[model samples]
Target: MAATIEMPATRRPIVVAPMAGGPSTPDLVVAAGEAGALGMLAAGYKRPADLIAEIADVRERFTGPFGVNLFVPADASCAPERVDSDSAATGVADAEGRDRADRVAVEAFRDLLVQAAPDVHVPTPDWHDRDHYEDKLDIVEAARVAVVSFTFGCPQPHVVERLHEAGICVLVTVTTEEEAHTAVAAGADALVVQGYEAGGHRGTHRVTDAPNQLDHLALLPMMTDVGVPLIAAGGITTAGDTRRALGAGAVAVQAGTTFLLADEAGTTAATRMGLTDPRLGSCVTRAFSGRPARGLRNGFVDRFDALAPAVYPAVDQLTKPLRARAAQRGDIDGVSIWAGAGWRAAREAPAADIVDSLTP
Candidate 1:
């Protein structure tokens, strides 16, 4: 059955992009509501208990509508122990990328391991996609979050059905028309049409497929009547861009770069600094997490992935300590500063101040 929600014609029209790892927080969510935009708290990379806390926090602060983005875990059935202490797990490097390394990367990784005690064995990441989905769903529904979204791809039918049953609005991020159709068929309440120029990770369902670079303007009408509300994302860096998206058929627009430097954002100083500097122009690479994500081009992405395996949370885990250390030493060259092409438009200010750029 098709799902439905009680959206008004004059609903505040902007949706905040959920950035993981500190950038998207409860404060950010409240600011989105305060600014008359819908904020989405990132549930990615956080434990279920932690996500619950954040949902509660946002509920306490904002009575208005908001969304929570879930990183739908993939169904790869590989054993997590395969890469544990596996030295072959060493990341592969590239020729042009080797020169980009700053001195602090490896040392930073080493020091953090000493403290976090990431197993001396270094097992591949223990991935449980369904577990994360179910646990998070319980929290979002309990909190009665107004909106819920999925990334990397839409979920199975049953999963989508459950969210709808809870009276929550669900949106899925898609990079292509195929995914757009797939999401609608699976019962998504809306679609977040992510374009190529957008930054951070591309939400292509099949990890191996080359990402579609169709800009939002071109892709928008191409979707033609997807039979659901369209919430456009990717590459929207300014108010003009937002207007264009809605003009092209989007019910609302979403953006990520502006939050890169928001005071409430958990972005590290290294990232905040690099994103603003022109010398650190961004590039997409599958190095750090074995997925093609756009970030401030760095030595780490340049060198690795020459032989980096396609394993995900595994690759993500192997490099966590390395990234943590580099960030600690203020090494922007080695850290991943995921930003959209609009990093140039990002402002270092409060979240409420940042979303004002997108306010209608």
Candidate 2:
């Protein structure tokens, strides 16, 4: 028998989205939990030891309920290798040669990067980055967080069972109704219905699938039959947006961009500036990372979006050094300023205050 994991009682219908890569801090999660809402710790791009330390820190300061978010590893089997005598490295090959095309596209983009910014030396892409999927899961299971949420893809049944056995409720993020159904079938206790307006990466399961750009309200009606607690995410910055989601049948709302400017967030100066820049606009681009993510438009994206391939963490790894150099110099154009459509409405305040404002 699977041990029953009880859901945390959150008084507020608000959830702090796990803005991985820096914004998700222990203080931020603690503040949100203290404010009667559920906060999430992002385990993406984190070392297992570091994440365990953070779990310990958050547990010590805040006894209330919180969650941990993990990125499900991309299926490497999707890309089969074939010899391309003309290519510089082993390239992916499809029956129709689509994989070879992707490799060519990525190489072209790489050349563009070199020419665009000669001073910044980019690192060799790490093809093996699964974001430490299994190790992170082990840490989460051992820590026994109140909730364990997955993004990028749905977890296998055994993974869900293991988490359930450890007394943790599982939540899967979905961008389409099909994904919602898949999550429900996979035994997710809840669904994070992320719409196209969300900041950062679109949680579409397959890298090849173009994200459905539906709004939360529009997608809500499509997912009502999934029969699980629904958490609406994306473009939810103001109280009105929160009200709309709840009225549309969501049990809770998750907002990330609203908290980007929060005192507790580790938002970079470049990101902060881009978020507030009047001329900057948000758009979906795979320039920074191979996967499609929404961010404030800048020179780098303008130059590389067309050239970028559909590859994910590989492209992400390729751009790491360049982004880091840009960040060090406070150059907004070169780094990713991940923001949602409502970025202009973001305010600088405490995470608790943001939760309070969003709470009805």
Candidate 3:
């Protein structure tokens, strides 16, 4: 039997979105918690040992409730199969053939990266990399964090049962009504309905499927019948946005872009400048990570968005060094400046102040 664990109530109807790749730092998490919002640590790209250290760091500074977000591995079998002329003529392509084609596409993208950023050394894609999913799960369950949220894909029923057994609540990010139903059936304690305007990667369950363009307000009403607590995400940047989401049936709201400029966030200087720059506009592009994510449109995105393949971590790995180099040099055009539609409204402030301002 699955053990029951209730979602911890926060002083405000706000959750600090777990912005992976850098923004979600221990200080930011602690600050969000102190300000009466639930802060989640992004365990997406970190090693298990590093995740353990972070959990300890958060525990030491703040005894308040927090959560950890994980990226479930994308199923390779479900990857979109590209049918070439030969396969098209035959009208039949086996799994092995499709796998080969996918590899070829990824390789071609790598070559393009090499050309685009000649100074950066792009690594070959580790096709089987699972982002240490199993190891991270073991670490988080052992750590016994208050909430465990998942993105990319839903965890298996047994996995959810195990987390429940550890007395940990589980939240699953869903971008559509179907995903919301799937998460509920998988025994999620809550749902984070991420909308089209969200910054960072869209949490679509299937890698090949284009994320739905439904805004959170329109999407939230469709989820009220799912029988789980709903946390609306996506362009939620102010107290008014919070009220609208709650009015739409969300118990709380999750926001990341609004806090990109928060004093405690680990957002890079280049990204900080990009977010505040008046000339840049936000758009969903696959240029940086192969996955569709909303960010400030810049030269890199303008040049590579159309050429990138739909292979994550693979593309993400290829661009990591280039992004790092750009950040080190404080070049906003070269780094991925992820931000939501409400990014223009974001201002530099302490996370606690941001949380207060977001609360009605």
Top TM-score hit: 3
Q: Which candidate do you rate higher for TM-score, 2 or 3?
A: 3
Model 3 accuracy (lDDT, Cα): 0.89
- Per-model TM-score on C-alpha atoms: 0.84, 0.92, 0.94
lDDT of 1: 0.74
Report lDDT (CA) for all predictions.
Answer: 0.74, 0.86, 0.89
**RMSD after CA superposition, every candidate:** 8.2, 4.5, 3.3
In candidate 2, list every pair of residues with a backbone clash: none
Ranking by lDDT: 3, 2, 1
Give the runs in model 3 whose Cα sits over 4 Å from its true position: 76-94
Of candidates 2 and 1, the better by TM-score: 2
Query: Per-residue alpha-carbon lDDT of model 1 for 255-317, expressed as tens digits?
Result: 887787887777778888788677787777777776678887777766674544444555667
Error of 3 at 212 (Å): 1.6
Query: 14 in model 3: Cα distance from truth in Å?
Result: 0.9
Name the candidate that leads on lDDT. Answer: 3
lDDT of 2 by residue, 1-360 (tens): 365455688989988999988999999999989888899999999999999999999999999889999988766221123345655442432324765676677777778788877887866666577988889989999988999999988888778889999899999999887778877777789999998899999998877678887988889899998888889999998888899999999999999999999998989888888888888888999988889999989988988888788888778887888899889888888899999988987999998889888976
Better of 1 and 3 by TM-score: 3
- In the predicted model 1, the residue pairs found to clash are 22-266, 84-123, 85-121, 93-303, 94-303, 198-235, 199-340
